[model samples]
Target: MSHAPTTLQERPTPAPAVATTSLSSRTLPRWAPLGFAAVAIVLGVGLGLVAGWHSRIQWGLLSALFFVAISYTVTTAVENKRQAKDRLATSVVWVCFVLAVVPLASLTWTTLSRGAKVVDGYFLTHSMAGVLGTEPGGGVYHALVGTLEQVGIATAISAPIGLLTAVYLVEYGKGALARAVTFFVDVMTGIPSIVAGLFILSIMLMAELKPSGLMGSLALTILMIPVVVRSTEEMLKLVPNELREASLALGIPKWRTILKVVLPTAIGGITTGVMLAIARIAGETAPIMLLVFGSQLINTNPFEGAQSSLPFYIWEQYKIGSEASYDRAWGAALVLIAFVMILNLVARGIARWKAPKTGR
Candidate 1:
């Protein structure tokens, strides 16, 4: 009527399958992506020459080959193990970044090449004054001012509301309020810029307000708010729960803790989000056209009258279909890109400055 004593060997724990997964996945070479890209380019060129389809064949081959390489990396690098997830994630991220860079660099080069002639000092300070046909003269001064004023006002409107909404969602909101805010933010994130412009336009019409920089700003605000809210919300959420708990333990109010700890901790991401939001809206053509009713000359007062943003200027002059107009349009595109780049750089600087310190 006796049972044998239990032993640790009898209760042996199951070995993790995760280790097997890591070994399987991590076997792929780190330099696989570069090799794949090189192969793609070479094969694409060779195949293009063989097929006589030139551009399409080369592009098709290159894209197919490059994507294949990325797929290979992802498949091999992501199998089974959860620990290798960081590697998998980084691999995909770098792939995406490289893919994006090709087009971006091409765009920059193309714009700079074509726009260089018209992007001189005069173009920066002068409006599209008395030059026509193939003749080139004048500048995008008016467009610059218009873009700035419109986007600045839009930022003024959206940044506060978006930040507040994120703050509420992060700090105060719960139940229906939080859910509704999240739902709306998600919905707004997908709203097209053209739709925002139309919404503002419709509202302006009903209210009998004339199209101006102010209205353009409102449209941009609509387009910007969702992005800001989402980004800020994510950033705020990244703040450690321990900090909040610590503050509460110190008898600090929840709101004060968020203000002092959470916001500061996530300020870097928040500022970057704000800049990206601004950049997104600043280049919108439909909103500017619908709200500001594009002008050829400088209108200093954003509140008082019609304005012309860089996008609107591009849209306008590109239609003229003359060399002069074409050159000017390219120059405006370059300027717009430059403005966004500068803003992004500034945001990066801010993010670095405000980034939270690490260490336990």
Candidate 2:
């Protein structure tokens, strides 16, 4: 009777056991990708040899493909479909990066290896005055000088005008005039260098002016202005409106505010844009050919006589069709590349120097 009234003690339910996995089991090993890559490379080389493929590029491509496929297959088997997809994407990105870098590396190596033979102090300081194109004993002095002068003149003429135009467009532009200016700039951006050269040639012909470095500079100016304008406009647009408003609230005239606050803030980018524009025009051969009338002797006076530039020198040497001429062309090309690289480096330095400092 008492047992009937007594309640049975309830047994506590045990918590369900969690499924445990070792970290190594759930994910790929640290050395897995390297091992896969090594295996892929070995297989690629073996297959290439068996197939009698001569090009190393083919082998590399095959290796990259194998790497991606192997990574996906292994990941899928070891992990899940999602992990395999991620590994596949990663492999694809790495392959793309290598593909992009390989060409640039090859070009640089080719240039350096070939150009070093002729790029010495003597090559830098002399001019192609007396030595025949078939005989190798000349330098790039005249061409270097002409390039610097013409590019300098073009920069001088284009930079201020472009900066002002960009300023007007970004800061003071309001109506149809701004839109028209923008339209013209866009049109000019796509205008062929030869067209600009022809336009300047027409003007020179009208003025009865002979082909000279000045004429070449005018054409380069035309080509450079659009680049500078577009680049500077973008840079100025990146400036914060809040800064402008803050300056205006302090009773600063719009012009003064732009000159002091806006320009200073964006000066780094503006300088970089101007330098890039200079680099863009530096290697233009069409304008130089149409106007500068390539010369063999040094012509420091850009206003009066024909001049030789790096591009013109390269072209002239290439036309000669001699071993010496080929060497000179390669040398000139290397120099031109170095010039552009130096400009870019200078732009980066200036950008860093003039970058706005932020308070912590």
Candidate 3:
């Protein structure tokens, strides 16, 4: 006997509908920072006046604090906790940046204002040989010459040695000798400029040699070499290992590969480092004062006679304790700063020019 067939029934279960909500955080306007800054400034100025505070610095500090607080609060309400936290951090960073910049800007502005009074054709061209410190008619011509010659000599001596040392450390350094060299380089980096001067001075005394720009250059070379080495080492380390291996696979010698491939690849950074080192030593006064034995007259021969540098000139002028001397000191300071700035600009330009092209 067979059982009768039963009727089959089927039903499809439907998928859940997608649900959406209209409660997204509001986006901050692009001009929010500007608006916040404006409000902060107004409130800060008002509060400063009401509190009888005259210093603009205090006002600015208050404004920065207010901006940060307001930014955090507004972002929290309109956006979310994460956005608020981000805005808070951004505000703090902006405040720190402004704070750091303010003092530098003030110093530069003050220097430009005070130095402009004494920086002129006569001030730049004439020597202080016949002119007295209080007479206000002298120039930095001799000092300028000395600075150029000493720095040029120091750079010429330090750059090659520092670069080679850096190359050795990065390309082939191994074992205790490399470690010792690195340790000494680090130690040299921390030594005071004055200490370097003292070292040279001691050497000069022992050798019975008189103070001269040549001696100053020796001291500067000590202070400059470590900086150059460290910077160049870092640049060399940044070169890709694949490039070196590729050159080796092509039957090129290791030395030739390093010289032609690696050096070219990292030349821009190395040059930048060298220029920075030059700037670091250029404004040093202690070494120059001890070794160069500042001269009022133009000394064309750094090896033969006493010479003057910008820092030494500034020091001498400031020590005279006269209005004219003070002006001259300010002028020298401005010139020195300008020289350093010019060097930085040139370094950046060279780095950009020499940097390898990534795309055809």
Candidate 4:
């Protein structure tokens, strides 16, 4: 037998050239294009100012150009095609920012310009009072109440059904029924507001809930449900499977798991989605026109009597043959827009405040 040496023999090691070669072969990360973006933006902005483009349109163009330049730079940088990624990214971002600002600025300018004629104290305090002819004065008090009632009722009706349906789809729904619901929700997502109005009108014709704010609420429910379901479903899906497994592992019922863990995790997003759904239907004129039958005077009884809403009032006033009516329409439109803006801001705030912190 060949005697084995007490000291073990060792194989010769290769030089570090292989490791160095491997290291050198490592390609750069794709984020490199950020450099070109910087260079393009600085270059483009200087060029824009040199040209006589001080208008909103000019700003928009410059912004777009800057975005493209930055995007190109980032792409190139990622591919190791450029060296100046940071500056390129910055320029592009600024350009995009400027572009974004222009539209909001234009919208504010246009809305104020057109709406100021109707935004007097009388416009805020007085109902569409004495809006008979050219000399203007009137407000949107009645419409405001109607809008609140209609949207409130819609939220009340839609929230339960939509949220429950989403829960079932996510937690309990199995095969065919779930697929059917998903398909229908997808279809409903794109249902035109006018179609929802028609559907409600047809139902009202059948049961004779005709031309009341209740009927308007019904139409809004149809419009709001799909949005709620879609958003809630997406939110619920974001809940980790581990949460479900852990709750079950603790011998808790599935329902409790959903209530305690899943819902709490996703509640922030759900609330924001619900608010957005409300905003979506708030401005629908067709449904209100068909169901509520807008009036100039306020009617608080959403169940029994016809009511007016800001959108419907705007529609009605704009059609009337009086300058006062037109002015009131613009003023009412501004108020409606303002309300929508506030709702969006509130939703954003709620989302931020309630969102779960991820880190320890």
lDDT of each: 0.83, 0.93, 0.93, 0.81
Q: Which of 1 and 4 is the better model by TM-score?
A: 1
**For each candidate, C-alpha RMSD in Å?**
9.1, 4.0, 5.0, 7.8
In terms of TM-score, the best-performing candidate is: 3
lDDT of 1: 0.83
lDDT by residue (tens digit), candidate 2, 16-50: 98776656568888789899999999999989999
Over the stretch 103-216, how does candidate 3's per-residue lDDT look in tens digits? 999999999999999898888887898888887788998988999999999999999999999999999999999999999999999999999999999999999999889999
Per-residue lDDT over 94-149 for candidate 1, one digit per residue giving the tens place of the 0 to 100 score: 65776788788788899999988778888899986565635668789999999988
Point out where model 3 deviates above 4 Å: 1-25
Of the candidates numbered 1 and 2, which has the greater lDDT value? Answer: 2
For 1-360, candidate 4 gives per-residue lDDT tens digits of 899779878999977754544226544444533454455556656777788655646645665676666665554654454544654566567667866887788787777777887786767666765565355666778888889899999999999999999999999999999999999999999999899999988888888665888899999999999999999999999989998999999999998998888988998889888988998998899988788877767688998777889888888877875767776777788888888888878877877777767897
Query: Per-residue error at 222 for model 4, in Å?
Result: 0.7
What TM-score number comes out for model 2?
Answer: 0.89
Screening candidate 2 with a backbone cut-off below 3 angstroms (N, C-alpha, C), the clashing residue pairs are: none
Name the regions of candidate 4 deviating beyond 4 angstroms.
Answer: 1-59, 66-80, 83-101, 113-117, 120-122, 320-326, 348-360
